[model samples]
Target: MNADNNLYQLYQSIELENVILSYKGEFTSELLTALIHILEAKMEELGTDFRVRKRVFNVIIECFQNLYHHIDFYDFRNEKLEVRKPALIIVKYKDGDFIVNTGNYVMTKDVPKLEKRLSFINTLNKNELRELYLEQLNKGKISSQGNAGLGLIEIARKTKEKLIYNFVKKDSKISFFSLKVVVGN
Candidate 1:
């Protein structure tokens, strides 16, 4: 009964929030591609401007990459729960702006570095972000997973919006990291 009511409240909230898409499950390349297509159709239906649609797609791809690459399942501390730590992606359109929110579990120890990096990114203007993105590209340090560590930077540059995040401790070792990015003026 409680769960039903909770879900009902959630449904009501989603309605009020103007959410266009919401997914909370394990992420994969195929699923990500499907999500992009779904949003592409939505943009088409709404007659979104070409430039704004491009920005929206760029930001969503980056967010999906972060979810795909940065999940820290090792910190889950339970073999039973290690199958797949589900992540979340929520897209909302409100007042001519599209808001994206992605959440995933991360190792608590990584919180400080992530917080610092995002804080620095938030402080930079569009010009500075471009410079930093180019500098990072020049460095060319790609991870084993093939990430060049430029997803956040690219998101910020494309959106020209501050990256908003919150780290909520889930346990002693694992925390939920939620990031929100806004695209369109």
Candidate 2:
């Protein structure tokens, strides 16, 4: 993925890459509500099975909420919060499955650490992932951004699919982190 300062440019590139569903804008509470509606409609339009729709919705919620809690930014001009930092949700339709692609900006210094955690988690089976998630949650430890970090682990456990991730250098000190998750019917 090409990294640019402009989010619109990122959105365009993702679309050109064959993204089926996307929303590129501020990740406000309002926008999150709209996204739920859009996704619900899209599932209906696609005629996805009821059971599969629920799984899709749950995964999307967890992924977006992670971005909502992390992926920091600030707006100096207006003294406001600029939480709209290049977040995406791409759904790729295949013959018998769907893949969800998501991404946002993360600090370059933290990429290696995050990669290690993701790699370790990816090696675990569903039971191991669940155990790890519960262990972390019981510790009540917070992440660098004050999140529980359990969400990602829980996502992996719930989906039972290997989480695919890549970190691309966006600039001197920041990286663009992307993740792809697959679900089959």
Candidate 3:
């Protein structure tokens, strides 16, 4: 299809998916805050119940923070990209469930470690997840990026869904890491 037609097709898909918010760019603290505000307003506009909105809001924050912090981990290495490619993020409400997804580039070598982590988290039940969260919290380990390594656990605990993730190799050196979390009744 032509470029315009391609764009139109993607737009139609997004609308049909009931996407509430979408952004694909470098995320900064200010931008994250702004996005949260926009989504909160959108939820209010849709008359989302207070409790549901709160849960969805918490998951969105964790997702955005994970995206933002992980990006900088490779900032020193990925500077050679064509023009500092931006990451992709989308939030949609479908079939009464809120889905948040984010994708960013990662070094191919690091994919295994991340994939393993998520795989383990997906195997846990709600109680197991709660236990793991507490264990990590008590350990008090912090990465150089100031992350306590609890974002995924927290997201799982809040959403109570198996995080859907994929790593598509973009080139010899880099891959695109995509993650999806769904929360609903």
Residue 177, model 1, lDDT: 92
Candidate 1 ranges with C-alpha deviation above 4 Å: 1-8, 72-83
My TM-score estimates for the predictions, one after another, are 0.89, 0.77, 0.90
Tens-digit per-residue lDDT, 83-159, candidate 2: 44667777776665667788888767878898998899899998888788788888877866667767788678656
Measured with C-alpha atoms, the lDDT of residue 176 in candidate 2 is: 90
Model 3 clash tally, residue pairs: 0
Cα lDDT tens digits, model 1, 84-185, are 678999999987889999998887898999999999999999989989999999997998778898999999987746888899998887899999999985
Candidate order by TM-score, highest to lowest? 3, 1, 2
Error of 3 at 172 (Å): 2.5
The alpha-carbon lDDT assigned to residue 14 of candidate 3 equals 87
Model 3 residue runs over 4 Å out of place are: 1-7, 80-83
- Who wins the lDDT comparison? 1
Query: How many clashes in each structure?
Result: 0, 0, 0
- Weakest 10 consecutive residues, lDDT, candidate 1? 70-79
